[model samples]
Target: MQFVNSKAFAQGLDETDPLRSFRSQFFFPKVRPDAEYLYLCGNSLGLQPRSTRTMINEELDDWAKYGVEGHVEAKRPWIAYHENLTKMMAKIVGAKPHEVVCMNSLTVNLHLMMVSFYRPEGKRRQILIEAGAFPSDQYAVASQVRFHGFDPNTDILELAPREGEDTLRTEDILSYINEHGEKVALIMLGGVNYLSGQAYDMVAITKKGHEKGCTVGFDLAHAAGNITLELHDWNVDFAVWCTYKYLNSGPGGVAAAFVHERNLDKDLPRFEGWWGHNKERRFKMEAEFDPIPFSVEAWQLSTPPIFLLASLRASLKLFDQAGMKSIRAKSKTLTSYLEFLVEDTFGSRDWIITPRAPSERGAQLSFRIPKDGHGVLEALRNRGVICDFREPNIIRAAPAPLYNSYPPVPA
Candidate 1:
């Protein structure tokens, strides 16, 4: 495919984009009235939709009007509130309604998932993960291994990229699994690498892990809203993600999890709380720890933050209206334009570390600067180009197709 000129390509893509109108629905941040900051940090925190204010207000009004009875009486009754958000989330992640649930923070949910899935026994005690998995995931995995009386240093295997490469090759990942498959208890990988923007092949990785009788899970922190996923079809054992990134839920919003149907009936002991208890018998205060099925709901710990759920509900409605397929189409073209601009302006002088192929990435383009990279990022920030800098050299730019437009890309 021939790449288009930066300015011309962005304009052309915007002209054809079906989801262009959705941009106005969000509240874009303007550090200066004359300039629109190119907010490309959606990989870390998505821009808030203007509609979120109204959604949040409605919940606040309900709280004022009903107080404790709001659980069952308020508009969008809190009693069945989380259930309302479930179907939409399930659709995005490709899972049954029962297979998905919105609840705790990402790390908290990761720990909960490990409780049920990481039951190490016999010789199957090692946990395999990507070398540069997000810090939260690293801590969760290490802690889980140590909790089970295993030495994390020895039992937790982190698969790094090849000697001189910046990204992990699929063959290297597969070979590692083949080498340690028998002794591995779980395979937890970032669906997309946070720094490299490489989208891993979940299907192949999950299949290989399951074949070795090891459970497979994913931290979709950077991948959830940025790309299309088929967690159910891929037969992934479990997965967890926060909605604040691409899902556009507010900061520190509740995260979600998915548990395959096959694990629904299995007696994998979870770190259960009352919310995960069977709904019908939950209020009865039963002593038995009966779970609500292996679907995402089984991981709930306590009451959900209704206000945050309200914001998510509104954002998800927008996602449903726009559809992931169309969003991804625009994402590919827009990011391609940004890549074109980077190469055109800096050429080989600056490194574009993220993969060039759209198939291998989402919307993010992580670029490495030749010298004084931090200063360049600071200069970009001062100039109203809002992107994030990872220590040492990389600057992650996510041209979010949902809220960001073509003009901000080059302005």
Candidate 2:
């Protein structure tokens, strides 16, 4: 599809977009009394779904009316409320129903998964991760290494890009794995890198990591609702993600985790809680920790917050209706159009630090802006272009497929 540099062309594409109507389901931020901002910050935080209020109110009303009985008597039943979201969440991350569970925040889930998967011993204690990973992941890995009585400087092997490249190459990653994978106990990386917006090849990475006898996992915070995933088929040992960004689950919504069925029944060390015990015997107040066998729910440490799950359920309803294939289809077109306009206007694609191929990225495009990046970001914000800035010299814009249109790109 050859893209023309004109507003009319963009409008024509918008008119033909199958997912165009989804844009109305979200409430956009206002820049003036009557006008809305061109919101392209979905990579940081998604626009709130219009139905979020109604969803939360349902739970609030139930609690007000049912009192303590709401645990078993509410419309969705607070006791099993997380179950209502299991199937939908499983679909988003490409896992079986029993493999996925919505329970805790992202970093918390990361620590939990690490407890079971990151078993370092002897000479194989190093954790291989990206140097430009999200700070939360960096801090989590460092603290985990320290907890295991290893020097983070020596035990955490940081994989960085080559001298002039902005994104990691698949061959370089494979080569790096071959070189140091034997000494690494866990291979953890972001499914879609936050800084560069590059989506890694999970299938290849998982296979290579396993070949070297290492545990593999991904922090899918940016990838879960943004790109195509197959955690089950890819044979990833474990994974975790937050639902706030591309999932449109409101602020600090309930996050989720996935454990392959192969690892579910293993006698791995984990922080156990009553919520993870056998549901049938849970109310009996038994003394033993009878974990729910062959289920990821065994990893749940406490009762889930239903209000947050309610908010995420509202967004997942839209995903169930739209389907991930359709979501990803529109995302590629939206992101490609954004890239084209940015390059056509800026004179070259050199301004873009994100990978050029659609398969290598998702809905976001990170640009290497001029020296005064913060000033440029403020200018864009003042002009109603609602994108965000990373530190130093990068400006990130995401044309979210769920609530964005082609017209905004060429506007």
Candidate 3:
């Protein structure tokens, strides 16, 4: 597709965009009196959907009216509330409905998945991860390795890009696994590196890990709604993600986990609670933990948070309506336009750290602006172009397809 450096070209893209109407469905932030900002920070926190308040208020009204009875009497039935999101969530992550469950926060779900999948035996006791992964993932993997009486410095192997490259090559990763996979018990990596905005080839990585008898999982915080996933078809062992970023759930919204069906019936070690027990005899208060068979619900820790679930439901309805295929299609074009404009206007593409191939990235484009990058960030903010700057020297701009558009309008 030929791209032109003009406002009219952008307007043409917007006019032909099927997802254009979705922009009006969200509430954008204002930088000054009556001036709505061009919000490109969806990779940090999404814009609130117009329906979120009403969805949440309905639950509040239910509590006010039914009191304790709202557990079963509410419009969504709080007793089985989390179940309401299972099907839609599964579709987004490309897994079977029974394989996905919305429960604890992202880090908490990571810990749970590690507990079940990160078993270290003699000699094969090391964990493999990307060098500059999200700090939370690094911390979780380090803590888990230490909990099992191993030194994190030695047991956790970090994979880094070639000295001159800003992003990793798939061949390098596959070669690393082939050479050192025997000693690695668990391979955990971010589906999309938060800093470079490079999306990993999950299918190939998962296959390589399994060939070496290692378990593989992903932290999809940046990949969930930003890229197309097929966890089931790829045979990924386990994965976890938060809903707030591109999913358009509000800040601190609910997170989710996915366990492959092959692991569901296995007697894996998991920290269990009552909500995981058999639903038929749950109220009977049986002492034995009879986990729900053939379902990821066995990992549930406590009762569902109805308000948060309501908020998630509101955003997910839009996802269900748009479909991941359509969202991803728009995302590719929208992000490419952003790249074109950045390079065309700025006169150079050398600062971009994200992969040039659309298949190797998502909606975000991270720039390595070394000199006074924060000044650039502040300037952009003052101009009402809302983007985020990462530590050391990177600025991230993510044009979300759900509510973000291509035209040269007020964002």
Candidate 4:
């Protein structure tokens, strides 16, 4: 697709876009009294859906009317609230309904997942992870290794990119797994690197790790709604993601997790709680923990957070209406157009560190700043381009397919 740096081209893309109506469904920040911000920060925090307020109000009203009884009497019924989101949420992450569950936050879920999957044993107690794995993941894996009486320095292998590259190559990752796979207890990675916006091949990595007798998992915070995932088919041992970023579930919203059907019945070590016990016997106050049948729900820690779940449902319904296939189609075009415009505008002044191949990235394009780049972020903000900037020197702009738009230029 040949892209031109003209408003006409941008307008043409928007005019033909089937998901165009979704932009109006979200609330954008104001650049001026009459203009809207160019909000490309969905990779950080998504813009709130217009329907979110109404959704929350529904739960509020139920609580007001039924009080404690609302647990069973609310319009949606609070007792089994997480059930409403099960199927739709499962579809978004590409998992069987039983394999997916919405519970806890991202880091908390990561900790819980590690409890069950990261079983370190005699020579093979090492954990293999990306060099610049998100700080939380690094901390979680390191601490887990330490908890199991292993020294992180010797037991945790950080796979770095080759000599001069900014991101890890698939070959490098696979090669490492082939060489030291036996010693590795777990292979963990952020499905999409938050900094580089590089999307890893989860399927290939999971296959190789299992063959090497290592458990595999992913932190899909940036990848969940931004990319197409087939976690169940890919045979990912487990995966977790937050809804706030690409899922458009407001700030610090509830998170989702996936546990493959194959691993469901295994007597894995997990931190258990009553919520994970069998639903039929939940009220019986059973001292023994009988986990919900063959599903990730067995890992649940507490009762669902209904208000946040309502906000997430509002977003997931939109996802259901506009399927992932269609969303992905527009994302590719939008990012490509933004890439063309960035190159055309900035020329050789700034560098785009994200991979040129669409398959290797999502909707985000990160630019490497030459010097004091913080000012560029303020300038972009002042001009209404709501993108995100990082500490070292990178600005990430994600043109979310659900709401981002290239407005028509004035005559």
Model 2, residue 202: distance off in Å is 0.7
Worst 10 residues of 2 by lDDT: 402-411
lDDT of each: 0.87, 0.93, 0.93, 0.90
Q: Which candidate wins on lDDT?
A: 3
lDDT of 2 by residue, 1-411 (tens): 899889999999999999888889999888876878999899889989999999999999999999999999999999999999999999988999999999899999999999988899999999999988999999999999999999999999988899999999999999999999999999999999998999999999999999999999999999999999989999999999999999999888889999999999888999899999999899899999999888999999898899999999999999988899999999998899988987788789997999999999999999888789999999998888988999879999998899999986312
Output candidate 4 Cα RMSD. 1.5
* Superposition TM-score, candidate 3 onto the true structure: 0.99
Model 4 quality (TM-score): 0.98
Q: Can you write out model 4's per-residue Cα lDDT over 77-191, one digit (the tens) per residue? A: 9979999999998988899999999999999999999999999888999988888888989999889998999899999999888898888899888988999999999999999
Whole-model lDDT, candidate 1? Answer: 0.87
Which of candidates 1 and 2 is the stronger one according to TM-score? 2
- Per-model TM-score, in order, reads 0.96, 0.98, 0.99, 0.98
Q: Score candidate 3 by lDDT.
A: 0.93
lDDT of 1 by residue, 108-167 (tens): 989989999998889999999998888899999999998999899999999898897788
Clashing pairs in model 2?
none
lDDT tens digits, residue span 19-136, model 3: 8888888998987667788899999999999999999999999999999999999988998999999999999999999999998899999999999999999999999999899999
